[model samples]
Target: MPESDPLQPGSPESDALFELEPRAAETVGFAQLARLPLTELVAPDWAEALAPVEDALREVLAFLAAEAADGHEVLPPPSYLLRAFRQPLAGVRVLIVGQDPYPTPGHAVGLSFAVDGRTRPIPRSLANIYKELDADLGLAPRIHGDLGRWAEQGVLLLNRVMSVRSGAARSHRNRGWEAITAAAISAVADRRTADGGPTPFVAILWGRDAWSVRALLGTAPVIASAHPSPLSASRGFFGSRPFSQANALLQAQGNGTVDWELPPLP
Candidate 1:
């Protein structure tokens, strides 16, 4: 008995290779292919092509689930795993990284976060930052209206640690999330433009821990700043509005501004 060659046409290994019987080259149609298992119909290279992305996503989800099961709580349920994965990973022009998810449930909707204000009602530090940005860019109350405008300009708002604790307890502190953050930074660094050119993306680090991860970003240039918490803001967090400054830098670099306004502070 000897090991059989998998490439051989009539070998048992060949059956595994071609899970679906070859269509007689006449009856192949979209309906027939749609009914077949993806693994059977797709070329071997197809799986190979997606292997890296699939593997990275699995690693991220597994890490998050394990952290949660280990008593480390995240704001949105692990169910939001799909939504997080659905987010655009690469080619984003501006990247904003915060510390962790807000302790409030249903608040970490992946794309939106609480900012102290009449419109959004976020934390104090966020209010201060917005106020400073409003003055610097001449936008005050309008900043509260539509924060999603940043996303339209290719700004990706993400947290270094996607999980947070709730209520009067700090029991949901993240212990092993730094690794996932590092992985995400790596993924974004490797992302390319649709036309095969290098994507010149800018990253904003809002908190101390978030800013500390700059070493993990490799070649990505990061604009570091104090955390946007009441304590940090009081200590001059908004002294230099990093978001507006980054945009100004982008403008100077030939990337013109979009239809955005930095409203006046209330």
Candidate 2:
């Protein structure tokens, strides 16, 4: 798929994509074409990689729209639905896959295991991730929970389920979000860097849910561990050293490492 022009000022493409489908179809199926207009929901940088899964993505959005119409609160808001994809994957060297968005209000900021900078007492899983970062890389812990620094430095924080109903964990599972995210993972693995070298990205899969997509990664390196939730951190998540291992994997691919020393958001 060739890239479309960048959306101009006050373009209606954004609004049209988010609007609920006014279709009269009886059954929801993968092959069902979406009536929604997608002007540029995905950045042009990802057009080729994501084109195959676009249909499934639209269906998942339809399910989300229906949920919202039924008064179900969605987490992280719509503006952040594609937040993780804002950066081009060509520069992305690390892929960190999480199960789903945080169900609590104001917690999930579209990136997996990340939240608003001002979110107090960050989610336990994020706290444990901070602890592991310190242990693995000797980086001191900061007061904020935002992971934008890592994202900017080529780490992709993507969740298996892009959206979830507020206050209801895994409420949006079994929807079409999985197929969409699976395609994203495949894009990362199949991506060839500048000069046409082999793909340079590595994947850090957390928990069984995140690990489920491992088969999609053709030859990309992977680091897997139990989820960082309190219940399972003690089992294998605590001392897994995923951060340092991920950095090593990236370096092996001749890519620069992520700056794990994230400062408190200003």
Candidate 3:
């Protein structure tokens, strides 16, 4: 179920994203990391759990920053990279993992399969998502591709690999992003809500890349289907009804349903 291209970056081609050995952060100290970009960008909600991997995350960001400083264009404008974590962890009821940020400039809003509200002619993959949403729940497709409303309702729309070089899809894979996101996904699967005997949760895994984390979910209900990309949606994604199935899983655990509705702008 991997993406169309799976060579990934950690191979000898791009060098490992994390190497704190002779060439790594041995000399760097707490006081030094205190001033790095990681402290400024990592949301407080995720700070403590992700602390152990802080150095690796910083290294990943440094690589991206270095790429930008070298005049390469990075998508989602940096600020949006961690936007998915703005919601409290306890509030999250659903997890959706996208392969990576959209390669087209301005098309990736940090959330998987989502774009900025003003983006025109939504990406075909996203359009297919809306089509499935309609078929599954009788919901109308939004004119704008912004999925922020879903995030507000406890839907974590995360990209397994968050950043990418403009016009190059999956160019950042195996570049240390996988390690960071894997921790985040595992944390979500393990969380137990305060005062709740059992918390309800659902994961919508659309493709091989997304399904790769299925083992980490530890029995968390999953709705697996083909990726919604125009290339593969017809194969299995269209009739899967993942949206309805997800709600049923959540309700089975006595939790509230996700508000999948995306109303058009006024």
lDDT of each: 0.51, 0.76, 0.76
Q: What is candidate 2's lDDT per residue for 102-160, written digit by digit as tens?
A: 99987877789998787898889999998898899888877788888888887899999
Which residue pairs overlap in candidate 3's backbone? Answer: 1-208
What's the lDDT for residue 33 in model 2?
18
Model 3 per-residue lDDT tens digits across residues 100-195: 999998687678889877888899999999999999999998889888789889899989998899998888888898888888888788887688
Q: What are the models' TM-scores?
A: 0.62, 0.85, 0.84
After superposition, which runs of candidate 1 have C-alpha atoms over 4 Å from their true positions? 1-74, 77-87, 112-120, 142-146, 168-176, 192-198, 258-266
Model 1 Cα lDDT, one tens digit per residue, 141-231: 4444234456556666666665555442333345544555566666666665678654567777776767776776666657777776777
Error of 2 at 244 (Å): 1.3
Query: Which stretches of candidate 3 lie above 4 Å from their native place?
Result: 1-40, 194-198
Regarding lDDT, does 1 or 2 come out ahead? 2
lDDT for residue 52 in candidate 1, whole number 0-100: 46
